[model samples]
Target: MKRISSFAFIFVTIVPFVGCHTSSQNVLEKKVEVKLEAKNNSNASGLVKISEYANGEIQITGTITGLSANSLHGFHFHENGDCSDNEALKAGGHFNPDKSHTHGKSIASTEYSKQHAGDLGNILSDENGEAKIDIIIKVPSLTLNDENKYSLLNRSLVVHQDKDDEKSAPAGNAGKRILCGVIKS
Candidate 1:
């Protein structure tokens, strides 16, 4: 009986490791580069990398150069990927996950519903107009394919002059739409 119990324990532990290795090997990994451009020669560029995990874990990194230091900027994914001359028009709208109204509020707001799908958080730059952002986001409703259902592909990243006020009107008075980019796969 003792021998049988020990064998069972070993098998249970070892089996999981084998299963994990096999599962890890089967997962499809993808990388994408996003080029950010300043609307009025703001001189800002950055790269965004996204990795898909099985448990809704998305790793994002945004490294920007040529920005104002010690300033708070609103960073988010816009509805459209268009980067036309008009940065405001190119960015489309904020990224609201709950289909809420347009508002530049905190990410923890309960009111101001019906928001856009790309309303992320803020981006803080360093003294030399550089900001490196690394975060893990949860996208429960996102897939790896491009079907226009809250898809990140062909989406634009917009940087605002001021912080988003989650409950305000017409972009929460987030100031000018300075930087824009199109997320590509």
Candidate 2:
């Protein structure tokens, strides 16, 4: 009887945790892939993996190489999915469906705003021209369906040659779109 009671208690305590874990994984069943643009037609390239979480948060994790060392690069999502243009101008402006002037928040800032959805602040590169990126974005909503404006799918990711000044109209004074990649599920 004592053995049976102990087993019952352990089972009850662990079951809820197991269930919650499974449920969360089920919610994040969607994922997006990003392919960075090459420079000078060389072998320079990078890729990013973005995963959508249960609570509508986005998990963006990537390792980008072939970038300038000890520099700050502007990272953002663009309106169009096209990155074919040499300058990636085909991606158009930022992902500002709301038409708000609220620019990107500083990476260290915790304040929230109705700013452009594509403004993801900046990405810093190490001295070796490499960057290990791991960040989360809590957008209003994200769906795999392209019809949804909040959907990040079919969007473009851009890396600029300069650091994002963090406060500028439209695109944050970040000069030259260097790398471009389309977000696809």
Candidate 3:
């Protein structure tokens, strides 16, 4: 009888705690942290955190270092996650799941159809060669759900040598990829 009462008390104490903890954790179901790898001798490295909210808003925040001081670098999402190639060619082109083949304005653009779904615009580095990223993408199509065609997971984030011109045909004339990081949940 004592053992049964002890088991019941323990179960009662832990069950509610676990339930409450899981319920609060469900707020951000899709959150991933990616570690960047340097390419093309750019010597850049960073940690990026991507969080998907319940309302379809994606928040990306991180800090990249070893970039050109006080300069702008083009940052975009690539279709492929492979970064084996030194030039980052293995990552493929920008993620344009929306069929917006044309490279239009980047994150600043309000029209989703005008730009590639992965077009994140330029990230400026400070004097210390560190670029802090804090951007919220309000696009519904770019999600973390594995079933979605436009899911960002398993994709690659590429940092370019130059700033995105925002009007170039193929990839905004961003030059060669200098850093790459695969996004995962």
Best by lDDT: 3
User: What's the CA error at residue 117 for candidate 2, in Å?
Assistant: 0.8
Candidate 3 local lDDT, 1-185, one digit each (tens)? 99999999999999999999877653565889988899998888999999998877888899999998999998999999888889999899898886745787775456676677878999999999999999888887678877477899889999999999988878989998999999877
Candidate 3: which stretches are off by over 4 Å? 1-26
In candidate 1 the C-alpha lDDT for residue 104 amounts to 52
Local distance difference test, each candidate: 0.68, 0.77, 0.86
Considering TM-score, which of the candidate structures 1 and 3 is the better prediction for this target?
3
Candidate 2 worst ten-residue window by lDDT: 106-115
* Better model by TM-score: candidate 2 vs candidate 3: 3
RMSD to the hidden true structure, all candidates: 4.3, 3.0, 7.8
For model 3, the run of ten residues with the poorest summed lDDT: 100-109
Candidate 2 stretches with Cα past 4 Å from truth are: 1-26, 39-44, 106-112
lDDT tens string, model 2, 12-60? 9999999998876636757777989863343346789888766766778
In candidate 1, stretches whose alpha carbon ends up further than 4 angstroms from where it belongs are 1-28, 86-88, 101-116
* TM-score against native, each model: 0.73, 0.81, 0.82
Clashes of each: 18, 0, 0
Residue pairs with backbone atoms closer than 3 Å in model 2 (clashes): none
Top-down TM-score ranking: 3, 2, 1
